[model samples]
Target chain A: MNIIVCIKQVPDTTKVKIDPETNTLVREGVESIINPFDIYALEEAIRLKEKIGGNVTVLTMGPPQAAEVLREAIAMGADDVYLLSDKAFAGADTLATSYTLSKGIEKVGQFDLIICGKQTMDGDTAQVGPEIAQKLGIPVVTYVSKIEDIENGQIKLKRMVEDGYEVIETETPLLMTVIKEINEPRVPSLRGIMKAKKIEIPIWDASDIGAEGEKIGLSGSPTQVVRIFAPEVSKEGEILEGEPTEIAEKLILKLKKGKVI
Target chain B: MSIKIDLSKCTGCKLCVKACIYSAIDVVEKKAYINNNCTLCGACVSACKYEAISISKKKKTAFDEGDYEGVWVFAEQKQGKLAGVASELLGEGRRLADELGVKLSAILLGEKINGLGKELIFYGADKVYIVDSPILKDRLDETHADVLVQLIREHKPEIFLAGATSFGRSLIPRVAATLETGLTADCTGLAIDKENKFLLQTRPAFGGNIMATIICPNKRPQMATVRPKVMKRAQRDDTRSGEIIEETILNPISSRVKLLGFIEELSDKVNLEEAEIIVAGGRGLGKADNFKLIHEMASILGAAVGASRAAVDAEWISYAHQVGQTGKTVCPKLYIACGISGAVQHLAGMQTSDYIVAINKDPDAPIFDVANYGIVGDLFEIIPVITTKLKEINGG
Candidate 1:
């Protein structure tokens, strides 16, 4: 079995701090790590490869520093890693980004299954996986919370919905985006990290992946950023300071005045 | 690099540096240089006072932008009832329509949903197009996208909007991809650009750390999805009338994925969306046992219990009660956040509540920023007092 998993390197948003005075994101000390959701995708791939006797490949489309995440995946037991990086691929929206990734996936050779995180932390637009499937003309599903079985080239899983979840079955040459509930990602073993350091991962650009220049970057992206602004935080709210009972009385009176009680 | 900096015009005022979320720009020797960390988000372009930065746009597209007309709302339905976000999108679409002097249309698909067309019309749609069929009853992305895509192609809407629910998020992307148009997700603000008359879609990224306004500069049928509770619902006018067209599915696409069954987790009693008052807990509650205080307070006030992702991930509460970017966006009459240090994600979900009360020992918690009333004390101390006061009122 050939399994390819797509991942992204994102600044750990959980650690992102905002400047108290300016209300802007403070970038100091923020570290880049694999998107939390994609860790589940890579982990599930490695587990499947272990069970079914196959190989797992990890791919990321980012700057050269993004290769660090590929190394992390390799340490987690992926067989191969590829970095799709080029200036031509910069400034792409979900549509252009997915198109570039799809082209890169095609160059990685045929695969029975492809896995991707539901979304990235930085973007959080869960549109890329399905868009890639659409661009590639393959069956796709999103928000896969579990993998029930893989047999006879068919995969059964649970897809999360608003009210609950739905059990689904689909045939391979399939792509699915996974949620965090799928699996617990494992810590890399020392030996695996040693192995990853020895490997020189291949770098693919727009040309190597056969992506049309007109469809890969800023020019290819349809959405344009008209403006970017920090959402204004309103005036500092009144903080009631007193004993618990007095504060409770104050709050109740205010609620009554506001017609909330 | 798509962005080019003209050193001759460089002032090194550092305004663009302050505007960039990525910290990709730095002034060196009176000129600014962009690093690889930049994704060309174009935030710097607007921040520069000197016009030192320029970006290139795509020269051509598959279709002429003038071919599309009217503003559209995807009227999503569940169990034969229209989703609340549909009404909200229609309300927003109505504004855009009036601004551009164009028609506002609603595209609805479901079995036995023809009657709901009147409601769509009342909510400000000039035209309601229905594709009522059994094949679309199951809410398969491919089936629904196939039907909606055909209508969009035929009608040629200039702006397409939908409620950013699980169904909308899953289904609309496929339709956008099929039509080869641009689609923005989870938009919190929508407006028509005054000069360009383009739909300006504003959304939060980096978990609500920054806001970006995007436009489909070259794409026809500019599409976007606004999160539920983020926009106001249209005022229904029963006396208003509009045209309802029964759209024909020229061809139905068969879905490769088979849905076996749906398992419902939320009970009807404590529906967060419908709850008038909500008392929420977070990691600061310390343990699952302390969470009982939140439940007690909520029960006393006849409010629903809510949780942050941390509380849910720690197994103190079920995910159904989770409120954040990854969870449900809720707007209640009164929201009391207890022991919750507000993260941006958590704030994204419940900031729109009519009245907010926050209780925590740490006064610096971001939750205090949005609260109408704030109490700086241990939740254990403050909640019991509040609960007792509520009980006294209930007894009287």
Candidate 2:
């Protein structure tokens, strides 16, 4: 079996500071890390490879610095890594992004399974994975919390629903978007780290991925950021402080004054 | 101006028509349709179980020079001080105002907020629209939105923006619906299309995997609600000056709702949003009794305790500590996972945490890959060591 894991690079939110006056996020000086959700996809792919005896490939589309995350994935037992990078890919919305990623997957050829994280941090729209599946004309089982069985050219999964869960059995070569519950990812060993340093990551451009000009980046994206701002905080809160009984009495009085009781 | 409703997808579910607090949708022939009075709040989209509703504009308006006009930010105030998000919107308004050569304005509503209006000017608002009344002191969603709709109807703005917080989220949809306008929510990016001065709105979709750009092309006063912490705020310049336009609201104080006594939040209460480090427990903890291990580990790291839905549902922890799609959304610095299998619902809440540490006996736990550090051992045994090490490190 062959498996592909799609990942992304996102800003470390802890370092993310909101500029109070401007109502915007401060992006400069913030370190970028692979999206936490993607890590699960990478782990699941590797686990499938170990069980099925096949190659596991990790893919990402980001700036040059994003290559570091790919190397980390390689160290954790992925057989190959691909970085889809190009200036034209900048500011691409989810619709355009899914198109580009789908093209990148096509360029990589056939795979038994395509695994992806449910979402990313910087852009918390869990649409790209399913969109890619939609564009590729494949079935997608989202929010998969458990893998019940994998055999007979089909896999059984426990899909997480709003209430309880549902068990699904899908044919091979299907796309599965995983949640954090699938499986614990393995740590990269010292030996794997050594191999990762020597590994060469392939960088693909729009042409390399066969993405059309109208389907890859900002030009292809329908959504644009017309403005950015911080949320208004209403701070008119008064601290009802006193002894428990005293505070309760004062609160009741205020409530009566406001006619809220 | 009219809203384009895709009639083909109407399932007659009426979720949207019913969800519309403004009574905008009508179900005719077992199909929901938006009439002339419809507000494009997209509540129908969220409420629609059949995925029947979407917003469309009639036609693009041709713009000549000086076409773009009026700037408004839905200012949310707390205790007389303006919310940081409100100020952030003003900074954005200032830039768009400068580019379009329009006056940047803010609609302020609250009790004793005259002083807040001055700060708005320092931040970049050219004018502050004030609606001050004793009845308007606390945030009553219905009344506040009514005030906003009335003001926008009277003093029309070409563009409007609001923060996507709880208050802003509740208010914007109602105002947009009342005005029969289009509204986009939780936008991460916003821009002005130089061509028609169209407010370009970009937001994540499909649960945060992709960013989608949206536009209210036909709606006047192109409106959007942006998420807090996604944009930068402007610097305060005390030298800058602006005007204050105060309006007297004659509406009776006795309405559907009234402000009650203020209850201060408990200081020791864990705000998962502000917590730097968190130790989360999951179903892998075996039983509710094992949550003590999670709490002990959290104490060692000087972190807060978080629970997965399984843990929360199992009654091992309260819902407040649960992190997932339906629970609180958190982005802590260090998230320690103890016997926690990373479920997507759970991941949705805390996947943005900076450094994740997973301690589970199962080497294949999905939590490990996202974890900065992985300890392939029983958390029960591992946590005690960590606790001891921490105590020694602290000389306690």
Candidate 3:
């Protein structure tokens, strides 16, 4: 199984709402989707390329309309799609977008498993899938919901944590990330959107992925946003409107005389 | 170190596209550009007002920022128990090592970690560091980022904190990419900069509707992680003391991953990040069998059920019963939100909990603006009147 999958094209921060009249962030119609848990890492890399045969590819680094989420991960089946776009790969972070997607996945060559998307709905920082598996020294396995057995090159997964789930195993140029309880992603077959609109999507850039204009963006971002605001939320609390067992017994007797029952 | 805009002092007049909260600025035919989701978080260079965005950071790395000093944290532990954001990052690393005057330390790493370095020097460590191997007994994130990147390249530590938990966000981004330095995730603010002392690090993006601060000047050890209930736990002092040291290195290479054990989710009995009462549920708990009335009011107040990435994306539970910022930033101390609708990504995880009690029948439900106690109604008619007054005060 080849796999690969590393999508991202966020801004649909759950439809980036909250602007109840200036309490900020409406980002209008907030569109540009595709990072809802990397569509279950591109549907578990097209169900591990339709149960172990090979070839799923899909990758992405943004800019050119993020090659429309690598043609929506090749209309859900993914055969190949790269993107990487440029203008010096803009202001990356997640260590220069996992060192420019591990130098565009070592210039796209071999791969046994690399899927990502345990984070990113506009960078909710799941630190770029273990920083692109520590820039490809491989073996990541984060929050992965499951994969369970693979074979002859070892895989076995599971992961999720915080008091539950861990089974891991790993081998074979690995990386993993997943979550959204890994699966149920399908949806896209009209001859797979006409083979993702008759293929032809090779974008690349940043010197065709050799990337390294001081390591890729905003002078290789070592975390630098200097300031940005809008936090203060206390929109004046106390909304106890009555009845419903008298506001649940006056909010549990004001949380048991404020001892927070 | 590069923001640049100046199209003849851009008249794009979009106020840096409403000070871009990672809409990454744009104006197109009018002017201001910088897109591809700009993380050069200078919030559009402070919403440029004709100084037309600049930024240019004076580069020049190659480490030396006076060869780092102390501050560290990482304490973290598990079966040996410790993490509660490791005493809230050693109480914010003893106030940034007393504002960079230096020496705070903590480190730890698990397995038979007895006295956990006197429970991290009774909260506000002056030094602890221990390693206590079992070859880090399969906590692997490249063996705890190669023993915290070889004790942060042999005692450097300008500012490295941890505990955005999930084993410090999978072991501090592999120790900030194996010490190529600069990491800043989940931090709910960290301070220290008064003119180049650096380590600022605020954090929050989109999910919390944007907050940013960040810094790493030239990265010596300025890492970050923070967010476990948003700092503040350092009081315990078994008569204050210091230094422990320890370190026994060498298990850094045999990895191709392994583990194979752990199960736990036996209906997770509280511990939603050390829950002190969480009850969450959202998408107005109108389904998923009404999460058993949020697990019968979290089993009558021994709370901890949480949810709401629209009820874990409508699966109505599990995503470890989510709770904001893409699930889990929790800071409970009585966070009862039922029918959750606050969404600034669920108030960036329980709006620093400490008693936020909403109930939401939508009286403009923005989780009652960080509820300190709200009620509005119909959580199936007030959670059976607050679980029958918490089971009649637990059967008296």
List, residue by residue over A110-187, the lDDT tens digit for candidate 3: 988888887886668888889888888877878888888889888889877876788988788788888777777878
Model 3 accuracy (lDDT, Cα): 0.79
Q: Model 1: per-residue lDDT, tens digit, A31-69?
A: 899998899999989999999988898889988888999
Each prediction's TM-score versus the true structure: 0.94, 0.48, 0.34
Candidate 3 clashing pairs, residues 3+ apart or interchain: none
TM per candidate, chain B: 0.91, 0.68, 0.41
Residue-level error in angstroms, candidate 3, position A201: 2.7
Ranked candidates (TM-score, high to low): 1, 2, 3
RMSD of each: 2.4, 21.3, 24.9
By DockQ, who's the top model here?
Answer: 1
Give chain A TM for each model in order: 0.92, 0.91, 0.33
lDDT against the true structure, each candidate: 0.85, 0.67, 0.79
Cα deviation of B174 in candidate 3 (Å)?
18
